[model samples]
Target: MIRTPKKLWVMHRIGNKLQKINNIIKVIPEWRQRYIVNNVEGVNSKDLAQKWASYTRDSSLFIKEDDIVGIEDESRLLEESLMDGELQQTLISVVGMGGSGKTTLVAKMYNNETVKSHFDCYAWITISQTYIRDELFRSLIKEFHQSRKEQQPPELSGKDYVELVNILRSYLDLKEYLVVLDDVWDTNLWEVIKVALPDNHLGSRIMLTTRKEDVGSFSSGVISYIFHIKPLKGSEAWHLFCKKAFSSYPDKSCPRELELLASELVGKCKGLPLAVVALGGLMSSKKSITEWRSVYDNLNWQLNNNQMLEVVKSILLLSFNDLPYPLKHCFLYCCLFPEDYIIRRKRLIRLWMAEGFIQRVNRITPAEVAESYLMELIFGACFKLY
Candidate 1:
């Protein structure tokens, strides 16, 4: 089992990090002593408890034909923006925190028959916070090529910046294409890519989803439309929570004994669909009232001390904290790399085994257990794969 040069380099970096962690543990008294204390007060948390007994999470979380709950109004607004003027290209931007349904909303429209019929071609590209310029262009071109399935598409291989731009602009000259640059983090990248798009004034649409409001402003100068997605309302949040928690037991309602606890749990989610879904998933597995009570009691600790922090980080932290104790170490092991770095499943499991984070089971290799742990984190939305 010879390792590639890249893997060797990664192993080297992991080794260095392990050394650093050793030094850190030496200075700290113990893991239990190192804790996050919430001393900041004044959040006057509203009881926000609804008298509702049933929860309603969406049956279809996919971005297929069916419309989802909580953002029906925003969908209409987005449709209006897309159809406002005739023969004019439009710049549409959607900004929201992570797990706030930005991606899901875009997915719904990206494949919708109406949207597809409106444009000559469609390109959906997920531009992570860290992106490669040429790779972006290649992907856009590839998707465009895919949409039409042309007899002889332009050769995109080995093209330079100016050449690629000319190729793209030429293809889009007389055509109306709906291009979605999802999760764009930098305006500079937009500027570089913008040159490749021919205004054509033919009703071409460029939509982007991002976590940064500045990104929306930067991408959408004048005459551009921006939709800022807020968290779900309390009722909507509860519905989503119920959907997740009671998906298997539709007739079941939060017992009278647990209604107060359930309402408080929903309130703590603060209307984020992903957080609600994650909690519901966590609870769905438990068969006892005490288990639900345990989550209800620990929601504050799981969410950390400050509720005033960034909503996306808070939601992500909640998901991470919900991972089983053994999975916790495996999930955190991923943080050794920089943010927005692409981590593959195989490499991550190998590293976990190296760090002894993977649990050994009877007749099962550590890698098998580690892979299962990784899947849990991914399904829980705490960990994302490349």
Candidate 2:
């Protein structure tokens, strides 16, 4: 049955309210205190409230909402995993190309107030291609100390890896902590470090961000919950571009003809935010439509030379390289579609099917085959689906 708009809005509000209630219940301290008699008994109501407030403030994690673009679904999934009971795995992987906002999304989650209030401790580490165990261990320990000042002897070893791992495990034996491993590349590095992390701690969450899907998949054991970051939608793409290109949104006063051309070029970026930002920065100060056209022309010329046109070409290359052989042909064939053209999916699929890309794969329907191909391209961030 079709639901009315009012009913849908009401349902949405109720869902949000329930989520907030769940978060409050999960993060609120277990016991309430009346009065402090010698430090063992209890604290005054005002002092108790002040202490709880400090704990809540200190434990918070979140990315500023303004800095984040989309991925509300991604944020919620990570939160739920972190909030699950003891033995709940807090590991989440965010995978995408460089500059595709994997770090941004994870930062948002880590800096969220709910995350801070819920977890007992927290850590953030940036792991690069060259993995340094000592550096990572030190960073985690530093965050732990900063978050909690109980100042028990430091738990890591200076030379022995085994002793260091043991110390880490002891430090977080039963603590609920959120750890973010950012810019990860090596799979084996994770295997070595996973042992040191605490297990079965309620509300504990870990997040991983990497450019390669294999890095994310291997680290997290190919879990069902993989959040693949896609590029921006058209409106989002335009909004981002305008923010970078003009001090404000470009309208008729900002040269309608040039603005129209800029919009077309933005569409060519396939809604990738980095691409939008880079291209906008490149063309922002130009007053002539001719220069915009020049950029449009240079894009093709750069593709032919294929040496280095900075970050944009690098991103485009990654997208192209990730495609399968047949899919490559299918995508290259899309060069036939004009800039800013809103190609109909059914029509495009029929065309590809006629061209013989979608056919008798175990007798699957043509529409299904087309849909699968589209999904693959979407996953690879090569194309945007409206």
Candidate 3:
């Protein structure tokens, strides 16, 4: 039987989508394998530790001040909060979606000499989602001691959890300390760890950087402020993009001929600092308009498949992977819509129910469940409801 042209076109589109799905399935396992290998038990090589440290280190150490754009107001406000807050130990958090410069802004303040001088001692601990309790205590102990240029205790490794907690409490009891808990994922971890930090009422602070908005208030019993970081503005994004993309050029300015292409590429980043910087760095070495045009044409493919952009991909994947199983399905279903498509709320919910991505709870309807899922995505910065 002869097939109609429309039917043949439909079959081609389905085939293409299936191929894309297959590629995504293949990449997921590779990502998991890499995580396991890197974080596996007993992988304690010094070189490996240093490599991971570099990855987790505050970007302020390596990133030039000139390259940091659009955060001057945020930096000043965060500094004021850190410096002039109540005497009681307060939990101040900088919350934002991943890659929105939460860590960078906090780190800049954490490293500031003026900020450091206000506190008696300071410690900066990077917390992972699956943090080992004893390991975290050890890092805290080391940072506290090292910040003062003093040697960490010789028995640090041998100490049990209780002993480590006691040591931290004793050390920080009388001192006004500024502790930065970076990249926090678990509220329970904060609940448990905060017990070791004494409230000396000497204007101490526990500053946190988290992607989750609720983690800050949940962890705080005293005054808590959650500073939400936003993506760069249009001009700021352009300035940052130029800084990275044209680092070798005088004034870091785009050439007149490539202005339109550069703006298009930067616009694709949607003012997300990490994406802008990553794409800028990726384009820095390519000198010709042809190369720039090639990159612009395949930008989406590069975001997903390019190794150079892995940091941006990994960050976004963290938010996606943190979603519940059903929510993940709902989120991916939404992605089937074309980019910049303004999906109507009720229609999207109905589509979710039809797709069987929403499950009914005992009291809640499937529509309610779908709405909650959409809100979760919005809160998680996976979706921007306009």
Candidate 4:
């Protein structure tokens, strides 16, 4: 009878083992399907990775007005420019390198109570690198009518590009309108869209943000009308960095022991608000001194290779990619120099000339061409003069 009980216990043990194996076997197909969906049958793995990175970055970097740092002066000046401008229609362009807070500053001003009260109607449109005229017109029409709480025309959906433009023009012809075009790329876009925006001689205003200085200059011919946004100053950058990095900690302050390492990491960001903010958010979850040291040590690699910092890379690359073919070569050549190396203007031009990045135009010598390229780089915010 004891032997019989022992056999039954063995059988029970075998049954449980078999049941566990069966459960695992049942899940194998589900795991296989997930692998196939993620790696083979659906979006490309690289694309999926990029999308995930973007989602993570955006979620972590959610900005509130109180969270905004280093733009108070900019906000005030931009507001004044928009609200206290000439009676004639004026175009004010906010020009800056990507990640310099052009959109943030303008968005703040666009939504200000004082600004809203000053203008009869407001329409904020985002004109990215690629825009369709008809689609833009439709968006404008909707924004203009909706801001005033007026119903759009029933036939709006049926109107063509010209009709849409006319409708917008006619609607804004009498009112003092404020229109914001964010992220403009090409000058020709402005030339085309400006026709639809009537001057109306009623202090109507148009605001645009662009990474390209030339685009800003084209939009607003006067120098005063173009606001060149700079990176955060040292103290401001540190303040902003601390705000993001220690947001969850008491008083949103960095620990005394970690302050040096944190400051070093912030310095790597070069005072670009987006970079500082993103890096801070990235460092927030890391609590140890060793982790902070690791980040500081590997920041250059992370900026180039890590997906979390991809947005920063993308923003910095915009200006680089916008360079002319020769200028692109020159800019890359400049990167060959060690960081913080003071590159003499004449020597750099000589290097460019040797590298064949400069060519003589009709009246301009190769030296002059190279000089022009350097100025372009400077104006594009790629290089800073000390």
Candidate 5:
């Protein structure tokens, strides 16, 4: 059976301790295989896909907050990029770390009344890492129909993929459109998505958001249009913390008794809005000051006991376990390089081949095979693809 999250966390406790035993390698894979056979051998494709898709949706929860704490500058920049362009079909990219309010900011712009009045049509699509192009087009077409309530667009349901793209292009003709493509990970995704979107030279614009700086740089067709979103500052973080922590309270502020503890908890969040908001949500359910103190105390205890590192290891372990067997070896082999080192892709591929991590595919060279495997890990959100 696969290790439980708790069991895996225990393994994290002794990961370095057992490194001297190379024979443990053969034992672990055998254990994993046996676990897979006993626990997950018979899951059907439909169920697996459904599980993965549901996980994707849950992971990318688009929370539209009642209070937007501090994004006025971002809001202005978004509008100016779209409105001030000289019918040049500008592309604006918003890049930030996950859970740093990238989606919240974009959603804010997507619903802005002034921005709404400027564009003939508005579209927002969240492209999960494992997105299907056909479903993507269907979503676009449906959004287009909804955006224009005047006419019932032609029956896109009966149409083929090519026909659907053509219909979407036609609908987007000449008139200005504001389209937001969120959480894009693959360049191949951009290739297919760009076809349906016509520039039209009508001051049309595309707004994109991603967590990777490299992906943002790649999508920025023009050099100077990317906006790198910083994490929330201390004051902003505290404000958001208070907003969520006392959501049940009329004033949305913490009581004096709990303010110090709340500040300590918020400080631990490291200015990440997602962490702050989530802590707020948890604290909102707390009935008394003692409970808030208890919550912070447990978290503080975990930090002191290095259980936070275990939690982090569990997250990275989950990502590590998702890789194919061959790719797993190559990825782990990357640790031989120095920390913060810049390794060339071609050089890395050669090392992977030498280490026998690159498997022989039908009519594919080892280099090609290794490169594709490396890319699968990178675009799978395991590593930043610089």
Candidate 6:
């Protein structure tokens, strides 16, 4: 059984300190598994070994070049957008659906050569769904000290904690830097923390990433500039799949039949990189054209079974279905078209008009209303077209 660090530590404390000694003794006979053994010496509890393992996992989370792919344009855009701006506390946000590469884009920015060379200081923190301002501050402090290889002093609490955060912000204020608040979901957190930041205007930028538009809009105040990242285009998606599935992009000697079928499936991916990779990997083991067709035929069914599929089509369907009533109706209507269809903006608006889904709002024409609904649906992950 895999034990959590907390459970093992609790067992060591409330039960027997000698139990760890017994564990060490039990591990000796299995010397082939010596690496798995925990050597608890000065530390009296099983928790020490668990803590060490946890630290090892945390250290390995750093991004490596081979692990990153297909985000060069995003990196340049973020770097230039930040450097071009002169305003204090410039907020640059990355917005996209989950698994659409927002976090990956931010990671590329955080680890890029120019970014590293340009900024005097940098901080990266992941704000999960349940974000707390103080927790975020502490995480930033830890990241700051960790990057500089400086020792963190004893933890502060209450008012001392607030003062400590101010100190960290002041230190950041002294140098030009990039601060990335990743996977942010709360607007309230921005409200509370934006006041604490020193307006060091030397091209310092704060980059945020979220799956929600309102969160980005509220934080950045320029919804137009919010980079709404999407999936890989057909060629990019095909290339990505070929690399992962065949260990190279179109490895030697693919049958014409197999190539055609693969192209068809790639179109259904709707430029979503993760879906392309997942479907490609799913068929990687089967060399037979028959097997490939069988899998391709059931792509829609596979989407619903998370256990058997890693594709996010089902989740995207959920987001699509959650749109406002008129938008929901309009989006579903587009599904009638063949996959990879290049939908003309004018034609789609006219169709919506015929269906009576669009009505005049303010002085905006019915066509504008239809177009706005389509845009909203697209941003919501409910619609995808070339």
Clashes of each: 3, 14, 0, 0, 1, 0
Residues 317-385, model 6: lDDT tens digits: 333334568876676565454322335777777767766888669988877788888766543434323
* lDDT ranking, high to low: 3, 4, 1, 5, 2, 6
User: Model 6, stretches more than 4 Å misplaced?
Assistant: 1-73, 85-87, 156-161, 220-224, 248-254, 304-310, 313-386
Model 1 ranges with Cα > 4 A deviation: 1-67, 150-157, 219-222, 305-379, 382-386
lDDT digits (tens) for residues 199-318 of candidate 4: 788898888888898888885432238888887889888988788789898998889999888878777777777677666756766799997876666665556776664445543443
After superposing candidate 4, which stretches have Cα over 4 Å from the reference? 1-62, 220-224, 304-311, 314-386
TM-score per prediction, in order, is 0.66, 0.57, 0.65, 0.64, 0.61, 0.59
How would the candidate models be sorted by TM-score, starting from the highest? 1, 3, 4, 5, 6, 2
Candidate 2 on 27-137: residue-level lDDT in tens?
544311211112223445445433322211111122225534656777777667666664555567888765566766777767778778787888877666565676577
Q: In order, what lDDT does every prediction score?
A: 0.68, 0.63, 0.73, 0.72, 0.67, 0.62
Q: What is the alpha-carbon lDDT of model 3 when measured against the actual structure? A: 0.73
Stretch of 10 with least lDDT, candidate 1: 48-57
Ten contiguous residues with the weakest lDDT in model 3? 52-61
Best by TM-score: 1
Q: Cα RMSD (Å) per model?
A: 13.2, 23.8, 18.3, 20.0, 17.8, 21.2
Minimal lDDT window, size 10, model 2? 54-63
Q: Give the TM-score of candidate 3.
A: 0.65
Model 1 pairs in collision: 56-239, 57-239, 57-243
Which candidate comes out best when scored by lDDT? 3
Write the number of the candidate with greater TM-score, choosing between 1 and 5. Answer: 1
When 4 and 6 are scored with lDDT, the better candidate is 4
Clashing pairs in 5: 1-35
* lDDT tens digits by residue: candidate 1, 34-74: 33212222212131111000001111134223225688888
